[model samples]
Target: MKYRYFLILFTFFTILGACNQPISQTSKASAKKVINAAPEKKIPIDTSKAFKFNDNWVVPKSSLDFNSLGDSQGDTLKLAVCGDFVYSPFGTIKDSSAFSSSLLKNFSIVTRTEKMDNGTFNFQILNHGSSKLIFFFDTDPEASRHSDIFKGEIYDEDVQFVNGIRIGMSFPNFYKTLFDSFPDDLTNNYTVVQIISCVDDIIQTYDFDAGKLKSVKFITDSYWKVDY
Candidate 1:
């Protein structure tokens, strides 16, 4: 009888120990999971609104003199110049008048007109060489009213900008020539003036893609303040 009793006690204790072992292992596993768990991420707060502006924000005057830069070698590559044709900010043409009799002889020209809601007309000229030109003219019947060339685009491989910058030129080379010729002080200035000698009165901007010259533009000074 005592032997059977001792056997029963041993069996009970063994079962209890096995249960305790699992509890201990479970606790250890839970602790490891807690230790290895990743922390929560915190979102950053924007504090720009708290910053204040001071007089130091004023932009300094540019040191470079842009007036001295001359036009490109070929007359066609010059600002407002195309194949045997030249357009000046001061020069004007009457409605439906030919661009140039001399240029018409050498190149086929396609012209289109779009009347805007305002009393103005938008004229687009496409030359045989794929050069595109735009002109804006007031609709007044006054003889003094003439069309003014506002923009032009050149895609010809042979043509280049005043500083030898071309359509396919690498961005680094173009930027070097641009900054070297123009002042680096474009901090707060709205307009880049005098990009070429003949185009001093007009403001210009350059566009690039993947470090390559994409296009050049002549825009109004107020264009900089446009919201997009």
Candidate 2:
């Protein structure tokens, strides 16, 4: 009878120990899962001084006119004015011999050569002037491709387009301001905004992807007609 009582006590202790073991293991597993599933902290963005300006702040003007502006207009467009400038078939007019000298005087040129699939070559001039102007050119001399400014980009706040349109302006503000200033030049398909200049035979395209001004492109009518 004593042995039977001892056997019953052993069985009771064994079951209690099994229950306690699972309880402790389950608690540890739950704690591990909680730690693993914890969300990571995120850094907050400060927007208080987002639109503040520094000393180099350039107040954008209202509009730019080709006829009235003279050589200043040519300087702004990075194109050579009439006088001794030779016109290229690609729509660029400059004294090719004096091109390097002129660029040296005005811009710090960083040239990048790129080869095309058709065995032709091209050059990209980055940070051309204070406006961060980028110019694309055909580099091959033997080929019909003229060494001319095929494309240009402007992203500097100091360089403003017609009617206060600038680099950092919001899409809504730019569109509204541009339309308010030059209503005739504005055209949009909701995806792209374009300001066409019949006088220069050039189109200035504004790309506002992230609700802000992303980039501005100036392409010749020849390019827009043939390639674009």
Compared with the true structure, what per-residue lDDT tens digits does model 1 show for residues 1-228?
999999999999999988877557888999999988969884442333121112222111122222232343421122221211122321334443645532322334455555445433445454436555555544656734122545655555555443465666765465465333222242223212234323333434455555455665544321212111
- RMSD of candidates 1 onward, in order: 18.2, 18.0
Q: Which one wins on lDDT? A: 2
- Candidate 1 accuracy as lDDT: 0.42
Q: Candidate 2, residues 1-228: lDDT per residue as tens digits?
A: 999999999999999988877557888999999999999994442333121122211121233221221222211212122211112212333433444444223445565555555554434354544444334443446644232545567666555442456677876686465222222122222335554442454555666656667677766644322121
Give the Cα lDDT of each candidate.
Answer: 0.42, 0.45
What is the lDDT for 132 in model 2?
47
User: Which portions of model 2 miss their true places by more than 4 Å?
Assistant: 1-150, 156-159, 181-189, 222-228
Model 1 residue 157 CA deviation (Å) reads 2.8
